[model samples]
Target: MVEISIVISLILIFDSYLLGKCISKYFNWNADYFPIITIGFFVILGIFEFFVFAFVKFQFSVYYILFVQYILLIIPIFVAIKVKVNLIPTQKELKMILGGALFTIIFAFLMGNQTLGEAAFDSNFYLSMVIENSTSPTLGTINGYTGNIENISTLHGYQGFYYFHSLLLKNIRNILSLNNTSLTPVYLWTSALTYFYMLSDILFHSINLFLEKKSLHTKIVALFFVLVFFTNYFNISFPFYGNTWKTLNIACNMLILYEFIKLNNKKSLFLLTFLNSSLIGFSSSGFFIACFIEISFFFYLIWKKEQNYTIYLEYWISCLSLLIFALLYFSGNYTKISILILAIYCLAGYTVYLTKRFDAIFWKKLLQFFKFIFLISVLLLVIVSYFVRNSMFSGSDSQFNGYSFFFRLNSLGDMTLNYFIPVNKIEFVRNCVFWFIIFINCFQGKYEKEYKFFLLLIIILFVNPFVTPFVVKYMTSIVYSRCFEIFINPFCLLIFYTGLIEWLEKNKNIEILFLLALEIGSIGIIVHNNISYYSKFFIPQKGYNPVYRVTNDQWELYQNLIEELQSSKLERPLILNQDIAVKAYVSNIRVLIDANTSRSAPAYSDENIDAPSDWLNIFYVRDYYGQHIWKQDPDYSKICDAIIDSNCDYVIMDKEVVVLKGDLYLPLWFDARGCSEVIYDNDRYVLLRVRK
Candidate 1:
């Protein structure tokens, strides 16, 4: 398993660099930009793969996707080689890259066992995805998760793009002849390593942004800050640690923001558009980020008089095409919608491109008119949203009820901001001092305009003052809150650091040693607070580590169950009560009632659960079917009836469960004796074959 993980990591590094080089060649960017660009290109490729395989039916072999991906890579490799792009790094750059790589390794070793805290279930879902996609790649449909449940509609829309990454990981595992159970650990390790790499990469670039002198001493000091800042892991945003995709979105957006700030010509605009669209494809929250980026860039260009309007129009059209195509494809359609959208966008883009040499005044007037129309449209939308805010409450989680739009927005903002910002009186004083320095430097700072514009953008978007009613009416608050973490909060931190670093560099008295000491001292305080904070929140589970996702006992039981099922020669066995862990670890198993949504098991879906009330209770409650109620012993007779009704071939249960019958509790195996034949039994788990 360790060898396979190392192999996968090497492959990831190589493929990302190659892809980044291939894509970056168009923009003429050097190898310094590869790490962040690599992540964006990889995600873009995965999303493109989804479009390419739109026609493929569910249950198709993962080998098909693998074959297509390699073929895709080969084309780019050929072009890149023919173009003779430089792949070498200078000594300084090499050191920075190695430092980042080393940080990834050490961070993974220290943090791999840690769960996602409240969101730990998401990791299980990801594991289930890797396991399921390792066999059959489903295009966002629930059919892959549900066994014997067929013709179910799609539940997850654009999220299908997210699964392709998991499929790619598992495909590599299969190529290396690794056991399926190795996927959980490999995934956890790779995610942790990759998450750390992103932070290190972000830190490397961000420090370079502020540092005019790239001396070895300055570099070492910056590296020291990275170590200190990240070691206190809880000081960072939770999504950065807990969710890989969300982290990718944050990185991509940050890169896009930086690119927009450097917006100069056609190439940069094209790169920004590519990154922006790719981010939108990966995360729905990215839509708002894209709007902010593109709009901000549009105005920035106008303000700077760069006259790249034609390219901006083309970029806008491309984004529109992508959004429309994704909407159509994930709407459960396998038709010509993609083709139609592409053609429409192509024609629109061509028309815009032809006007590049048109009179400047005419183009300016046209842009102004478009701006007027857009502003009016936004105004009307905001007004209309106020009347429709009540609609969001219907069929939604009751927890969101009774809170005003601004209250909900502020609450969500506080949740994400709390990770980095302190609320203590000491922190307030420290912030006041820091802000005082930043305020004095603002008048003559090298990046004053850029940093202030970013701050203003954050205020407008973060507070979302004008759009609160509209946001509440249309979008989920939790989902919208991610915008704060992914863009707003990060930008706030970036502005703070960029200003402070610039201020420090201007002051000769503040040597590298002083800066390093300040960073260490500040981070030490934060680390102390984190130890206290996390000790209360992160309770260790039995048989589980802070670094690993699965418990040793659960892994052993799943591995044993897989071996037994294989030895028994059950082909694509439909399983009941297997849960996400079993569905993920045991290859070739189809679940009948996942008891969870089809985020992991795309085969079995709950989207079609519309039975009458009594039947709903039978399957959802009384029978303990179609639900995962932890520690609640199921009624054996009802479970048997459910297995029969659902036509499940096998049923799995914890051997420790004691079924409740009237006034007495009895061992599950004893009560379930006549229901099924025991095929596999162990201290932790029991697998039974339903007697049809």
Candidate 2:
């Protein structure tokens, strides 16, 4: 246990430091977020540790340890270094030091010695995450997950990700010869921590940057953006475990931006080039696409301002190198490196224009500039082509209407959270629910020119999905490919808030009042929305939910329900009433068919045959993957069929949703056919058995 503890600490340190070093080295920025990040990491670990030590042997195995501790310390750094990433231990050290006091204070408040580590679900999830960790210790792989990712395991759509991660986890499980899968509470908390801290990193930098340019009053506004964007109402609403990494991608992208803004050296340029490239590549194309927007804006700024490409030519080369590396490393088997090569060919061809056009001294500089810009443009075109191919191929079906609808209604509530000023002694959260709507407007409107640019770029980030939610909803419901879009809306908000705060620094009264309103609104919305949504469904999720009050009581409550399900003698299979619910999925349990995937098929699939698609919903609804399934009606035939066909046992699902009343009678259909029976019931959910 001690050895394991040490290993955990090392991993945490390595993870934090590697990111810190890379940020400082390549971006030449003062990004020392270790205190908060470390606290977040450890607080989460400590939460789980309480339960682990409480029940387990707590034995010490440091002596017999494989001595991988050293590797743990250096691997992340080495990887960054091998890539010749320029990191700044000195600047990072200072940030870590200076930021330490504040981090300690905030962390203590966030954690408060309440080790929330106790197991909240079946041990299968626990064992799976551990066994899975042994084989695939690859960088960026979230250590472990709880659910089985077989054909039938989805709650909504075909989870291309679930399958992908499962393959890696299964291999590790096999090395240890484990036959079952499980997720630990620690896995949940750690994963959550990873995402939260990723956002915190962005908030930290953006806030600090805002602080640099603004007054004390304006500082608060900047902080407001920092908090709101990180605690995006949408994310707080629909935070599934799978989507946790999506949050990470956004924070990482922001950090990349913050770094990009502070680049001071070739090394920093090089690292920013790679880190941002890889982050967006692996995390999602949306973030990288956002990065592209940033790149384009920067290029326009550089070229338009100086009217010369030679000045930033090296940086462009670095970008090219990073792009090449990203394609080589981050691309899947289907990746096309040749796309970039083609751009290179065009660039070389374009150089003919430069060579023929050059005469003497006057023309030489012009010719050189043309050649450099032409080459860079060619390289860039190749990169763009690769993305275009990926985009054209990647067909998704998520609707923005669902997300947009949720955001508008909840904006007030989110503002409440933002204005929730922790007075340290207040036993209860201050209910500033009143200011939500008014303050939420703080996030809206044209704030700053730079902010406006960010907002416009953010909208442009939705370029891949030209069709809005109306089209998407009517076209494709419950498709898995639409998951990436989940982050775009909130992330754009984050960038906007960042830009807004930066613009608001000129006014003190505006900053403070703006912050108060913003915080109160965001927090209130989350807490209220969370509670209201869960009254019936009882899962940790949000979306398409309509009701009264504000805040996320449902989410907080599910933490306990998750506790009950995990430790209950019955070991109920976790069921989700709605797909947008974050906790149900993040809990890493196999779920009943849900919002994650849909039951419908779209014509686009037939029309865009080559549109690389993820039929996630089909797998679950049709039992193609043999995942967990449950019905509300105690039907014999359907249950029997499900058990025989999909190996389902007990199914725990909500049966009281008014909108779903028609479908909820599926169990009744089974009973009419004489297939299944009810085993348990509550006001919210009805449990049934098919295997027996």
**Which of the numbered candidates is closest to the native, going by highest TM-score?**
1
lDDT of each: 0.52, 0.37
Q: List, residue by residue over 283-315, the lDDT tens digit for candidate 1.
A: 555555555555555555444444565666746
Residue 439 C-alpha lDDT in model 1: 70
Q: What are the candidates' C-alpha RMSDs?
A: 6.4, 13.1
How many collisions between residues are there in candidate 1? 18
For model 2, residues 581-628, the per-residue Cα lDDT tens digits are 322223334444333233222333344333122212222232222232
